[model samples]
Target: MLYPPLHHWLLGAVGEGRLNWLMLLLAAPVQFGPGLRFYRTGWAALRHRSPDMNTLVMLGTSAAFAYSLAVTLAPQLFPAGSRHVYFEASAVVITLILLGKLFEAIAKGRSSEAMRTLLQLQPATARVQRGAQVQEVPVDAVRLGDLVLVRSGERLPVDGEVVEGRSYVDESMLSGESVPVLKESGANVTGGTVNGTGAFTFRATGVGADMALSRIIRMVEDAQSSRPPIQGLADRVVADFVPLVLAIALVTFLAWLLVGGEAALTNALIHAVAVLIIACPCAMGLATPVSIMVGSGRAAQMGVLFRSGAALEELGEAQVVALDKTGTVTQGQPEVTDVFVDRGWSVVDGEQHLLRLAAAAEASSEHPLARAIERAAAPSPITRQPPSRRSLATAFAPSWTATRLRSARRGSWRG
Candidate 1:
């Protein structure tokens, strides 16, 4: 329908019937060109005894175009008051439906961003130990049981069991634990986890598609392709809706033809076409599948992977969701917040004295709590005297002594 101002302006400028031929010429190609898809699919659906939304669109637009063509080509057949053309109605409906399809395609393209991001996580190469020599090779070239050497501050190339040495691994990406996990001999390590400041060699146990990262990517792909259970209900209703609308349109045509007086033919055709056009099932057919795909993909992007489409649908039914406290609510990194000093010391800078000693004692430790203590004492002006690593066998020693100078402490304690 035209807006009030535009309708009034058009009528004032051109009167009436002056632009009907131009409209008919502009609409003819659109009615038969890309619109051919509707006719082909609609005819197939009707032949199979299961008419669908395509059939309804085809019938509605074709009826409107046929009647408008009749009116435009031979206006004298109808009474002077009933002669009218509706080329715009038929053409506009096809254009709008095509535009909706284009938008749906664009949404499908955008939903794959999560999968692309997941694929980007896997490293391209790995360092493998060959007999007495170490060589770098493609990740896929490393075989099971091959000894893979990983240095400090690097991502693990594949899932494997440690063969020698010790380190702490940050598995927060997969396990949601902020604290770095200890990886001693025989301990298992996963691909994509970052290693702490220690070197280690591990036997490759899972590579290529069998790696944990690859399996997670596969789960995301499966979840995106799967159809949720709710889509079945929509499919059933749409199957029945087309036939119900066709029956109503037939009844409307018969009622108008028998009861309407001089304008019975025009009245029947117009009302019947209106019922079919308004009952198009484009939205009903598209809503369920598109929502499922987009929802699953967006969830993966947010670090929440749905196992399947059913999980995505069932998520709405949950009343209480249990979440991990470390990674979900707080940053996994630990930092010292408060410290208290012993009462009997009577030292002016007792807190700084204790913090410097604590930081030196923990300087060789790889634990997160030790790092937090070190960070807290970093501002103290005193030179930290850390114990020898050769003497300290374990990261957390029961009792270790570090000599502190009283002169270095007088500058400032900024903790």
Candidate 2:
């Protein structure tokens, strides 16, 4: 493109002969350097009698570059207007295709982020009770029936049943529930779920790969690897599509050569190269796999894991999507929307006083409702009192014990 414009600027500073050599110098690296992969794959496919998108790219770009090189080296063989170089054509095509593959690579890397995040959810160590001694051991060392101890604000190491303690467990990781579920003796608790403001001892029933979190991660990975039916059909079509395009290009080259016209050789080669370039099957070969991998990965990021690529493809045809209200619509967190106090209770600060008392009572608990009350009373002045004999008695005593205050409290709740 700079040939005519820049050449006319300095009264033909660079002659056409030198400019042609310059084009060859610049385009040689682009044709063989980064574009070598296409040549190797395309040749291998051809020798195996199975042509693909790479074959089309190799044939088209090679034909254009060869014709241009010949024109530049020996311009006397062709007419004046016929002696044109296509260095930009070959270079641009290869650059664009390589850039596209780079973007596809980036998308593939992004798709694995969700899987990495899910893998991080599993704790590396578990607190196991062994003959009256509680020891922290690698989670992989934990065996079925082992007693696992989970404390407040800790994630369960494996699926188990509560054998000896009472607590509220935040199972929102699996169930998407806004409120923590109460766990007691014989209640089943899953791994990866967080414990509330109480401690509990449970017998591990599912360890290692058998855990629910592991199964979920495996499902997401399988979905990413599984091929959709449409991709198989596309592969079949592309297998035949390449040969058909080659046949068409050959027919075009023959027809143009045999017809009576000026510069018939040049026209035949140009038309055939055009046919090859226009018939590239890159979209057909790349579209299905790229979409499946990217869509499944993005869905996993949004907490929607598919079982297989076919399921992901079918999801596109879904007209109505049903979603649960709690986590899906509302954020799955509780808030104190309103305060209700009885007229019989004598309170100096009204709603603020009631909220402060409630926050103090539930301060030791980690349940969603307790957190909500605490947030409501955060702006008000709080009186932090050390644990006294009377307050300790009130904390442990069943009369003053609120249902949400299951955790052991070390301070007084007389705010």
Candidate 2 has a TM-score of: 0.74
TM-score of each: 0.79, 0.74
Against the correct fold, how does model 1 do in TM-score? 0.79
Per-residue alpha-carbon lDDT of model 2 for 44-161, expressed as tens digits?
Answer: 9888988766777788788778888988888887778777778778887887767656655555565567778778887899999999999999999999999999988899999999
Off by over 4 Å in 2: 2-12, 223-237, 261-263, 281-317, 336-415
Overall local distance difference test of candidate 1: 0.76
lDDT by residue (tens digit), candidate 1, 113-228: 66676666667889999999999999989999999999999889899999899999999878888888899999999998999998999999999999999988787667656766
lDDT winner: 2
Candidate 1: give the clashing pairs.
none
True-structure Cα RMSD, model 1: 7.3
lDDT of each: 0.76, 0.77
